[model samples]
Structure formats: C-alpha cells, structure tokens
Target chain A: MKLRIYALAYLLFLYAPIILLPLFAFNDATIIAFPLAGFTTEWFSELTQNKALHEAVKNSLFIALMTAIFSTLLGICAARAGAMANFPGKRGIIGFVMLPLVLPEIIVAVSLLVILRQVLGVNLSNWTIIAAHVLICTPFCIAILNGAFQNLDPSMEEAALDLGESRWSAFRLVTLPLVMPGIISSMLIAFTISLDEFIIAFFLTGTNPTMPVYIWGLLRFPASLPVVMALGTLLVALSIILLTLAEILRRRGIKRAGGTDKGGFL
Target chain B: MGLLSAPFTYAILLLAVPLLAIVLFSFWTQDFMDVNTTFTMDNYREIAEKPIYFSLLQRSLYVSICVTIVTVVLAFPVAYFVSFKVHPSRKSLWLFLITIPFWTSYLIRVFLWKVILGYNGVINSGLINLGIIEEPLTFILYNVNAVIITLAHAFAPFAILPIFVALEKIDRSLLEASQDLGESKLMTFLRVTLPLSMPGLVAAVLIVFIPTIGDYVTPELMGGAGGKLIANMIQVQFLQLNNAPLGAAIAIVAMLSVTAISLLFVFLNRRWLRGRS
Candidate 1:
C-alpha cells in the first residue's frame, strides 16, 4: 500500500511541472505566482505575433526534418551492415559509433565548436547543428533499426536473390519494405530528439537560432517569462504526441517482425 | 566491401577527429592572432596551480554523486512497484507515462524548477498562503540543494528505466524458492532481488552520474554564485574568457576523472557483491 502511494507520488512529481506549464500559460497572469487569475488565450495568441519566435520555430523544424532524414539514412546503412556483415572489428566499430550516445553533449558541443571555428575554419550554421544532431541521433536510429533488421529472415532475402533479383534490387524490394515501419519510427524519434536538443544547437548556432536557443535567449528578459511558458506548454504537448506516436510505431514494427518486446528506451 | 565499411569510416572521421582536436588544443597555446601549434604543458600546469578549478571540480563530483544516490534510491521503489505490483498489461503504459517528461525540453524542465523553488516561487508562495511560515524559505533555491533536486528530477526517468528493466529481468522462480525456504519478504528481497538487479543499478548510476557531473545548464540556471560547477568554469574559459587551452584541459581532466571514478565504483560494487555471497 505504501509502495503504491509512493509510485503515485513519483508520477505526480514527474508530471506536475509539465502540467503547471499549461496551467500558468492559460492563467492570464504575467507574474508566475499563484491565485486564480482567470483563464485567457492571450499568451497563445501572442505567440503568433513574435516574428523572431516564428523564425526560430521555422529554423528548428527545418533542422529537425533534415536531421531525421540524414540520420535515418545513415542509420539504415549502419544497421543493415551490422545485421548482415561479419567484418573484422565489427563489434568495436559499432561500439565506437555508439559512443556519442553516452558522451557528454557539452563536451561534444565544445569539441565541435573548436574544430569548426579554429581548425576546420567552417562557419557555424544549420548544417553544423545537423551534423552534430546526426552524430547523436544515429545511435538511437541504429538501435531501433537493428531490431528491425535482426528480426528479418536471411532466407527471405536469399530467396529474392535466387529468384533472379540483383543484390541491390533484393534489398530494395524485400528488405526495405519490411523495415519501412521501423524507418518511419526512426525518423520520428530522430526528429523529436533534434527538435528538443539545446546544448549542441546553442553552441553551433550562427546568425539564426533554433527554438530552444531562442528560448534560452528569452530567459534573460524577465518580462518574457509568461510568453516562454506559453511556448513551453505548446512544445510539451507536441513532444508528448510525437513521442507517443514514435513509441507506438516502434512497438508495431517489433510486432510485425515477430520479435519479443524487450522494452524500448521510452 | 568498401561501401559496406563506409559508415564506420564516417564515424571515425566525424567523432574521432574532433576529440583529437580538443586533446591537441589542450597542449597548444593560443595568442591574439591564432592558436599556436607549438605544444606545451602550461594548460595542465595552470589547472594544477589554480585552486578554483580544482575546488569546483570537487564540488561537481560531490553534487553529481548526491544526485546519483538520491535519484537511484528514489527510483528503486517506483521501479519495484511497476515491476512487481503493476499488472503486466499496464507496465508499458506506466513506462510510457514515465518517459513523457523525458521527451519535453530539458531546458524547460530545468527552468520550471527555478519557478518552483525560487524565492517567491511556487513552494514559498504556497507555504505563505498556508500560513506554514512567515517568511519564504530562501535556502531551497540558488544553492547546491536546488541543483540536486532539479537534476534528480530531470534524471528520474533515466534512473527508473534501467532499474525497471533490471527488475523485470529477474527470474521469478528464484524469488519463490527463497520465500519457500522460510525467508522473510525483506530477506528474500535483499538476497535475491537486490543482487540480481545490480547490473541495471550500475547502469543507472553511470547514466546519471557521468552526465550530471558535466551538466552546465542546470548549474548555470539554478545554481547561483555559490553553486557554480566545473562545467560552468569550462564554459567561461571557452566562451567568455577566450581561454580554449584551459577549457580543453579542464574538459579532458573532467572526463578522465569521471572515467576513473566510475571504474572504481564498479570495482567496489563487485567486491561488495562478492563479499555478500
């Protein structure tokens, strides 16, 4: 009984701040204090007029979309290779590729900043941010896709090849369609990760900033607190929806491949 | 064959190159015009001589250790409840709900703690309204405690998921056997459950500890003057102070220390487990 209550309390603690975001957003109070201030949609309406916020949002969407595509493409290659090939040092190589998943993002941001600015002499841009996002997102993508690829029967692909299909055509016709759901799942997850990422974007942003970077900038001004809260409410809602969709798709893909659910990172 | 190996090559070039650049920069000196390629040990010497860097590094370690311990302890019971008490049908739903907060913006989550804990923040106002205290508690915000609470909250899901996975993987027959042998519930849990879940628990510790130690955002926003950490100093060195070599040196040192500490923790944990059996 005590344990059940503790679990409920833990869930409440986890969700309370997120719930508070929408509450205070709609509460019509500029100051982030208590007392019922009546409900209003003014903050949400105000979000439309902030041109800089719009640009930041647009930039973030573009970056996230591109990151999803690039990372998923790279992930498909790596996961397919991992499932099919038995090259020398394969385990070590894959482990090395996945290292960025656990390496501190601040360290990655700092190191990338130094390399891009000082050594490589490349200007920081959306492409730089995309590169870094791909570095982190690819491991997640690989993990998801590895599950998809491993579940595939090698005999199916072999049958396709024996039926006079070329190797590339066999992969395109047989393997690709089988993993389509997993591909979509990986893209959605990678997109969500890139959208929510802050530190790397914060460090690598050039003239234009991503949404989180813009939000960080807004934090310095005391008056923009409610506006930021309003934005946070929307972002939280969007993230929950997208992440739920991704999780569902991932589970469906696993089920389609006839793999036991070992639980996901979700 | 060459095409099959391209991804590995790309990973090497992208990840390894930047890391090597940082290490090389740590040894080289920088002047007004450019970063001089000439290598020197001055960066490491400066770090050794400076007490502030060392102290802040120590503080970061201490804070991260606290966050790890607190998060793991709190997470265990919740994971236990979900793994043991909850219906198998509802387990995924519970996990999905737990991860909802994780998907939200990390910056926003950290910032919300500032609102909740700030001097006139949620807790203080609520307490004042309830007549619990005449003055708002000042100690709850702008200190190490605030950083720990916020970080632990942010990382709760991280701690919970691994431990839950560990708990879920425990063989049920072993538990039944222990209980059938006339062991108390607590005793069975201590001997059977706790030891079996060590892998997940260690994973939770490493996941929370390593990142929290190097976290700059939480310390920057929630941690006021007194609560600043080593990452903050590293940020200043690179961004504000124009001291790349020093920052690189600090980053390398911090990474090495984290590695050493984590290995030591694993070794100690193994010894404890061995002694127990």
Candidate 2:
C-alpha cells in the first residue's frame, strides 16, 4: 500500500508540469500566474496568425522530414547489415555510430559549427542542421530497426533467391516488406527527435530557425510567454501522438516477426 | 558488400571527423580570420591557469552528482513498483505512460518548471490564495536547488527505464528461493533483487550524470546568475568570447573528466559485484 502511494506520487511529480502546460495555455491570462482567468482559445488562434512562427514551423517540418528520411535510410542499411553480416570490428563500428546517443549535443553542435564555419568554409544552413540531426537520429533509428531485422528469418530471403528471384528483387520483396513496420517506426522516432532537437539546430542554423530555436527566442519576451505555452501544448500533443504511434509500430513489428518483446525505446 | 558498409562509412565521417576536428582545434590557436594550424598548449594552459574554469568544472560535477543521486533514488521505487507490484498486463501501459513526458519538448519542460517555481508562478500564487504564506519564497527559483529539481525531473524517465529493464530481467526463481529459505520479503529483495540490478543502476547513473553535467539549457532557463554550469561557460567561450580554441579546450577537458569518472564508476561497480559474489 505504501509503495503504491509512492508510485502514484512519483507519477504525479512526473506529470504535473505537463498537465500545467495545457491548463495555463487555455487560461485567458497573459501573465502565467494563478487565479484561473476563464478559458480562452485566443492563444491557439494567435499561433496561426504569427508569420514568423509559421515560417519557423515550416523550417522545422522540412528539416524533420528530411532528417527522418535520411536517418531511416541509413538505419535500414546499418540494421540489415548488423543482422546479416559478420565483420571484423562490427561491434566497434556500431558502438562508434551510437556514441552520439550519449555525447553532449552542445559538444556536437560546437564541433560541427567550428568545422563548417572555420575549416570547411561552408555556410551555415538548413542542410547543415539536417546533417547534424541525421547524425544523432540515425542511432535511434538503427536501434529500432535492429530489432526488426534480427527477428527476420534469413531463410526467407534465401528461399526467395532460390526460387529464381534476383538478390535485389528478393530483398525488395521479402526483406523490405517484412521490415516495413520497423521502417515506419524508425522514421517516426527520427522525425520526433529531429523536430524537438534544439541545441544543434540553434548552433548550426543560419538565418531561418527551427521551432525550438524560435521558441527559445520568444522566451525572452515576457508577453510572448502565453503564446509559447500554447505552442508547447500543441507540440506536447503532437509528440505524444507521434511517439505512441512509433512505439505501437515497433511492438507490432516484433509481434509480426514472431520475436519476444525485449525492451524498446519506450 | 560495399552497400552494406555505406552507412558505417558515413557514420565514421560524420561523427568521427567532427570529433577529430574538435581535438585538433583544441591544440591550435585562433587568430582573427586565420586559424594557426601550428599546435600549441596555450589552450590547456589557459584552462589550467584559470581558477574560474576549475571552480565551474567542480560545481558542474557537484550538481551532476546531486542530480544523479536524486534521480536514481526517486526512480527506484517507481521501477520497483512497476516491476514487482504491477500486474503483468498493465506493466507496459504504465511504462508507456511514464515515457509520454519524455517525448514532450525538453526546452518547454524546463521552461514549465520556471513558471511553476518562479516568484509569482503557480506554487507561490496557489499558496498565497490558500493563505499558507504571506510572502513568496524567493529561494526556490534561482538557486542550485532549482537546477537540481528541474534536472532530476527531466532525467527521471531515463533513470526509470534502465532500472526497470534491469528489474524486469532479474530471475524470478531467485526471489522464490530466498522466500523458500525463510527470508523476509525486504531481505530477499535486498539480497537477490538490489544487487542484481546494479548494472542498470550504474547505467542510469552514468546516463543522468554525463548529460546533466554538460546541460546548458536547464541552467540557462531555470538557473539564474548563480546557477550557471560549465556548459554555460563553454557556450560563452564559443559564441560570445569568439574563442573557439578555448571552448574546444574546455569541452575536451570536460569530456575527458566525464570519461575518467565513468571508467572509475564501472571499475568500482565491477569490484563491488565481485566482492559480493
């Protein structure tokens, strides 16, 4: 009974700030204080009319979409290779790839910034940020897709090849379709990570900022706080939806492949 | 064969190249519009000579340790409950719910805490309305405590997941055997469960500690003047001071220390496990 209550309190502590996000977002007060000042949808409407915020959102979407596609593509190759091939230094290579998972984003950002600006003389742009995002997000994608690939039976591909299918055609038909759910899961997870990413985008972006960078800029303006809260509410909703979808797809992939569910990112 | 290794090659170039560049930059000096490629130890010297850098590094380490300890201690009960007390059918559901907050924007999460703990924010206003306090608490918002609280909250899910995974992997028969031996439930848990979950606990500690030490966002958002961390200093060096070399030096120093501490942790954990066995 005591442990149960402690767990409940812990959940509350984890969730209270998030609950506060939507609560005050809908509250009709500019000042983010107490005494509920009636419910309002003005903040949500304000989100639509802001031209700069719209541009920022567009940039973020473009970056996230591109990041998802690139990272998931890389992940598919890596995960497939990891599952099928036995190479010298394979574990070392995979570990190196996943190092960015725990490496400080600020460090990655700063290092990339120096290389792009100083050594390479490349202009900072959306492409640069996408590169950095892909670097970080690929590891997550590989992790998700690795499970999918590992669960697959190598005999299926072998049988397809033996039945007079070309290797490419066999992979396209057999392996690709089998791992489709994992691919989708990887894309969604990568998209979410890229979308919410701030530091790398902040450092590497040129003029156009991602949504989080824009939000960080808005934080300095005291009047903009309510709108940021409203934006936060929307982002929170979007993230929960996307992440849930990703987790569901990941679980379904495991089940479909007849694999026991080891733990996933969720 | 080449196709399979394409992504690995890309990873090496993208991840490793930038890291190598940082290492090179740390050893070189920056002259306006021209980087001196000649290697020098001045960057390291600057770091060694500067007392402020050393103090900030110490403070960052201290804060990170506090956050790690608090997060791990808080997470254990939740993980224990989910692992042991919860019904099997509902365990995944509970875990899914726990991770929902993790998917929320990290920046906004930290910012939300600012609003919740600010002088005129939620807690103070709610308390004032209830006539619980006449004056708002000023200390709750801008100190190291605020940084610790916000960070611990941020990292709770990270701590919980690993520990939960560890707890879930424990052999149930061990618990049964301990109980069969007439051990108390708590004693059985301490003997069979706690020691066995050390790997996950160590992983959780490292994950929370390393990231929190280098976290600039939380310190910038919730940590007022007094609560700045080493990452903030690194940020200033790169952005404001126009000293990439210095920033790279500081980053290298920070990374080396983190690596050293992590190694020490793993070594000590191994020793402890060996001693117990």
Scored against the true structure, residue A31 in model 2 reaches a CA lDDT of 86
Candidate 2 regions with alpha-carbon error over 4 angstroms: B1-4, B128-132
Model 1 interface root-mean-square deviation: 2.0
Q: What are the candidates' interface root-mean-square deviations?
A: 2.0, 1.9
TM-score of chain A of 2: 0.97
Q: In candidate 2, what are the lDDT values of residues B51-154, reduced to their tens digit?
A: 98898888888898899999999999999999999988678778888877876888889998988899988889888889999999888898888999999998
Q: In candidate 1, which residue pairs get closer than 3 Å at backbone N, Cα or C atoms, i.e. clash?
A: none
For candidate 2, the docking band is medium
lDDT of 1 by residue, A1-266 (tens): 99999999999999878977987889888887676498998988999999999999999999999999988988888888888768787788888888777788878888889999898899989999998998889888998888787888899989999999999999999988888888998998899999999978988998999999999998888788888889999998888888888878877777777676666653
Q: Model 2, B176: alpha-carbon shift in Å?
A: 0.4
TM-score of the candidate numbered 2?
A: 0.96
Chain B TM, every candidate:
0.96, 0.95
